[model samples]
Target: MIALIDYGMGNLRSVAKALEAAGAQEVKVTAHAKVIAKAQKLVLPGVGAMNEAIAELKKLKLAEVIKEHIFKKPFLGICLGLQLLFTESEEGGRTLGLGVFEGRVKRFSNKLKVPHMGWNNIRTQNSELRTQKCFALNNIPANAHFYFCHSYYVVPEDKSLIATTTEYGGEFVSSISKDNLFACQFHPEKSQSVGLRLLENFVRL
Candidate 1:
């Protein structure tokens, strides 16, 4: 079963419906930490400010549960879910993040358009994915377009964790992976065929 964590700040229904369409037999969107702990796989999808997201997680006490098991299971984070894994964010005056990875999320420069919306293709960074064999990106064509909607992006201190990158103002971390944890700044759920393929790959994993 996959637990789609609902911290009162995510697009829970769309994520759940996407998982179902991707062949996930069971998916539970819940705020209860116990439900999250017992699930075999976990999906953290979020939208909105990092500060509010963190506050909800803390209020529900799911933050600790997530910090404890994020690396143990097949954990996937989407959009804000990806940003929350970092140490801090500049979205709302340098708000702190979950600190699972050494990085900071920064807003796009005013020189470029704020909130980079619409479709963009990502360049795979992981060596295993170089041959186009990474499980999450399996069968998906190279430089495939994925839907995106965000104003800020993560910058991991350890470049090795970067799975894919996309260029907006410049190149930014588009996706990240380390062991059981995988996350992406793009909305795979909304990326059409390639998007569904990514979700299918995650469910299969």
Candidate 2:
């Protein structure tokens, strides 16, 4: 079973449907720790404020559960889900995060638009290695377009973790892949065919 974590945020049903379309036989949207623990894979998809999301996760005691199982399974994070893995976020005046990755979430510069919405193409960082080893990006063509909607973005301390980069105002980290984990700032559920292909790759992983 693939656990689609629900903390009262995100397009849960849409993501769940998309995962099923990608061939996920069993996808459970749950906040219960036991359900998550038994899941074969975990997907964290969310939107809205980071502080509120973290507060909800902690209130439901799902945060620790996620941390414990994150490295043990094929974990995927989307949008706010991706942002929460970092050490802290500037979203609400230095709100702390899961600390899974050594990084900080930053807001886009004032020169450009606040929410970097709509379609954008992601370029694979290291085509040779990523194409061969990154299962989440498997069969996904480089420079393929994906849907994005967010004002904040992650900046990891370790550049090696960066899987893909996209340009809005300038180049920004679009996705990151390391071991059993893969995350992106874009929403695969809304990206159409290429997005479905990406999810299909993740389901196969």
Candidate 3:
């Protein structure tokens, strides 16, 4: 079973439905602790401001639950979900994150577009999740395209955790992994075929 956490701030229905269409045997969207705790794998999806998301997460007492899941079970975070795994974020006057990864979310300082909303290929930083292999990914080359929509990007202090990277204004962290956890700044659910395969990999794990 795959648990898609309902944090009251994510694109919930879209993500849940996408998981079902992507061959998930059991896909659940909920805020219940027991249901979440029992799942073999969990996914955290978030949208909007970081501070607001953190506040909601804290209110639900799911913060510690999330921490526990990442420590024990396979975990995947998407978009703002990925950012929340960091230590802090500059989204709203420097908000603190879940500190799952040692880093901060930074806003693009470049003169280009603020929110990098479009299709851009991703460059693999390592082979943690097989971004270069055909078994888990198809046609996901060194820089295969994926969908993205965000103003801030995560900056991990440790370079070893970087799984893949992308360029927007300049290169930034596209995806990251640490043991049971795999996170991405891009929305694999909305990225069409390639994205489906990415989600499939997480579900398979």
Candidate 4:
């Protein structure tokens, strides 16, 4: 079963619907710790403030539960969900993140736009999501374009988790992967066929 972590606010239903559309056997949106810990895969989807998301995770006492599960299972984060995985964020006064990835989330200053909302191409960097045993790509194209909706972006201190890159005014970090943890700055639920394929890929993982 795939578990979608739900706090007070999130793109809960849209993500759940998209997961089902992608043919996931089971999908549950919950804040329950045992449900999250027992799930086969976990999807962390958010569309709100950085601090608020972290606060809710902490409130549910599922923050550490998620961190523990990521090491042994497939864990995915989206948009603001990706941001919270970092060590800190400049969203609202240097707020701290979940500290899974060693870095900080910074706002865009490239003069392109505050909130970069549109379709963009993705270019892969250091990626293992391609040839993993259960994650067979078959005829699917890797590094294809997906939907993006965010103002701030992650800047990993290590630079190794960067799986792909997308441009907005300047080249901003798009997607990242570390072990079992995969994340994207875009929303797969809104990216149509490309998005659904990505979700299917994650589910199969």
- In lDDT terms, which candidate is top? 2
Ranking by TM-score: 2, 1, 3, 4
Query: What lDDT tens digits, residue by residue, belong to model 3 across residues 90-121?
Result: 88898999998899899998797878999998
Cα lDDT of candidate 4 equals 0.81
TM-score of 4: 0.91
Q: Which parts of model 3 are misplaced by more than 4 Å?
A: 125-139
lDDT by residue for model 4 (1-205), tens: 9989998766589999999998998999989989998999998999988988888889889889988887788988889888988999998888999998899899989666778888888765435323231232223465677788788999888776677777687677787877767788998889898788888888877
lDDT of 2: 0.91
The candidate that achieves the highest TM-score relative to the unseen native structure: 2
Model 3 lDDT, residue 201, Cα: 77
Which pairs of residues have clashing backbones in candidate 1? none
Model 3 gets an lDDT of: 0.83
Model 2 lDDT per residue over 134-161, tens place: 6788878787999999999999988888
Query: What is the Å distance of residue 160 in model 3 from its true position?
Result: 0.8
TM-score (C-alpha) between model 3 and the true structure = 0.91
- Deviating ranges (above 4 Å) for candidate 1: 125-133
Clashes of 3: 0
Instruction: Flag the better candidate by TM-score, 2 or 3.
Output: 2
